[model samples]
Target: MAGGITDTGEPYSPYVGLVYMFNLIVGTGALTMPRAFATAGWVVSLALICFLACMSYMTTTFVIEAMAAANAHIRWKRRESERVINDSDSMSDYSDDEVIIRDRVDRSETRPILSVQPGVSPDHFDIVERVEMGQMASIFFNKVGVNMFYICIIVYLYGDLAIYAAAVPISLMEVACGNHSCSAGSSIKYNDTDSCWGPVKRKDAYRVFLTIFTLLLGPFTFFNAQKTKYLQIMTSLMRWIAFTMMIILALIRIGKGHGEGKPPVAELSGVPNLFGVCVYSFMCQHSLPSLVTPISDKKRMNGLVLADYVLILGFYSLLSFTAIFCFDNSLLKDMYTLNFTDNCDVIGVAFLRYFLGLFPVFTISTNFPIIAVTLRNNWKTLFYREGGTYPWVVDRVVFPLITLVPPIIVAFCTHDLEVLVGITGAYAGTGIQYIIPACLVYLSRKRLQPVFGEDMPNKHRSPFHHTFWVIFILAWAGSCLMFVTANIILTETKH
Candidate 1:
């Protein structure tokens, strides 16, 4: 329902909404998950992933609730303005003596509706109006809060671009250079110095692919790129095919008792990376506003969201479990698709092998321009002032250039998908996914109570409506940041 629209201007069915959310939540993050699972151990990874999924789902509800509240506030203001204008017009027609009487009557009639009182349901939490997260932040947050929200989103998007930029090339490098023969087995690790084409090192091959990727897809950022509905469908189809192939192949291998994995029950050292991976994988908060706004019916929205999360949780669990059990923990590639490429025992066909290996290249390449544009637009939004405009050069050239350059530079410098995802998801992602939603909902409730009164039935209020949940989410986010920061510092020190 978010992007899909009928010719008749009708919103999509709830089932379609379910599918969109599923596609969004399951992306490149899922590919990195198997390696994280292998490192963190099956049992620990399972527990942590479940916990993180629940947390993400909780914050998702918060965002939906805030959306509903924001819509209600918009509706209330429009109605109030209409009433005021009608009253003012009617008063103008009356004489001086009669004006006093009419004004008193008007005040008496409108007082009950405006004032906080029992049984006054002024704000109905129906998401008819589409208020984006940024608008909601501006409406509900103070100046500092709004700035923090923008910063978090900008950082997350940059991270997303970097991940996409790196993923495509990394996949290409692995596919182009690595042997297609199955002789390497699950235990062998490919190094950066390995030959890709003739004397071209794999690392150099990655850079070459990165440059080509930028050249081909980067220019779209300079222009307005739109009407990507078909592209989205194609990418979604490819993603499902690629993911299903890996899962089924892993299952087939494990069923035959040929799994090389012997992952530990718990690996403390791997928990930080695993935490980052899970956080990144579960991210759908930034896009939730678009996803939730166009639903034709939202009575079952909560249930639909819950079902989606449950299914994703099960899917992630199934994929990661099968992967950790099928491949040796030491040999699991950062990009899981690479695991299927050279292993003839699992995938005998060379064409499908190359397809699976280059799957990220195919899917993520399509997404890079779109994300780059989004980042560029956000840059404009962040610096935009009311009743003012940017110079043509700054508007067209500078913004897109800034958005496109840094992530490419990051990708050029390092192709570590895992670390990129981890750092991005752990820091900026935590703020976007957890802290922002919690604050938005909490602030929305606070802002709306005086206008709508305490008894106004909000249809989309989160089950975790207590103050403690907000505190808990924020606390969890803070603790995760500290943990990840400490891990990074210590790892660098050791290196």
Candidate 2:
């Protein structure tokens, strides 16, 4: 043992691994997943969640095991470098000793002394068997172009909270209080040809304001680059708190009656949209860290599989079931969270607002590192300066500029939050999270065989085996394209 509790080669504590994965997998994604289920039909969506959970568990564990192997290789290399430096120093010290002895000894004795054998060969000291785990990993990932494509796919899949949808719950809250000032419903008349209802092609000012808030929040993510350690700790803490709040909310909805009878069709539709948001938002990249832990200890990775499923399904089921009673599917809006008003005491509302705001902030912060990495790769070549002197220019100027685009389009185009989330989730969600990862896993596995000389056992084979991913990839892509078409069909031209 290295010390009191250090195994020197052990994985992180099982509890910590579970906690981290729960946060990563169920984080922002949960917020909207409930509504998505309601939209897709609760029965079908529930089945899919179970299926995805299984896939995620198996895939995540495999990736972590692979990462641990690579970590072992890196440690081996570092130790070898240190030994080389130490051996050279020892040779210099021995040469000096020989010189001192030669000056003091008779010339005739030198021949006899030279015949004495050295006690040990320095080259043999601390010899470690070479393991090409790192090279194996690189070959595995690069062969299928996964290392490059994975991040892009993740980014594309993470289509989350459109600032435009922020208006939905706000409008719902206004209606609950018997106020019609910002009601999007009253402002529009449906036209069969245009296929949507809105203020005779008018702008939704309130939605625009919400969109502005979403935009303002985007750049704030960059602030995280300044303090990663603190952010991680805080993120861990906040995630738990968020999870707890969700559970409590679910419980309350379960125990209490969801209020009077059947909800409207629109509200029901919002359910699926909300569910989509939660599912997509729950996705996180923390699974990537297992790539650094030792193999012998990699079993700890399974803890996440257990934690994410239990908590995620628990949270999602409760939220969806309660939503069935309390909300009319027809009245569904984007920020259904805002609709949780009747369930709130002062403290609950405060927590709700805080959580709602905190997630966007955190999501933006988490996303910044990725966007930063991407920008650096694409733009750094253009700068051609040592240490990337103009980095601040990109961070300070270019990022904020880029951040504005999505919010602006959303502000003008979107009137209902539920509709917006559904559109984004159906298209972006399918592509980024499910489809892309499946492709990377398949391609990366092919690369691993040639390099590692073996296949990673799939105790948990993807439901359809390798071919299933191909089917899934195409399915998700088709869904995304279809949703985009729906958006075009439903949209009304602004004159």
TM-score of each: 0.94, 0.58
Local accuracy of candidate 2 as per-residue lDDT tens digits, 399-482: 545544444455445445445555555555554445545544565456434433353333323334455545655675576466
For residues 1-495, what per-residue lDDT tens digits would candidate 1 score against the true structure?
A: 112112323478889999999999999999999989888888999999999999999999999999888887777788799988987898888898999987678677744455555665544677776777888888889988877887788899999999999998888888777777667654358899887788888999999989999999999999877637899899999999999998998899999999988989988888998898899999998887777877888888888999999999999999999988898888889999998887887888889999999899888877787888888888887887779999999998999999999999999998888899988989988998899999999999998887766755898888889989999999999999998899989999999
Candidate 2's displacement at residue 171, Å, is: 9.7
> Which residues of candidate 1, in runs, are more than 4 Å off?
1-10, 95-123, 183-187
Query: lDDT value for candidate 1?
Result: 0.86
Clash statistics: count for each candidate: 0, 36
TM-score of 2: 0.58
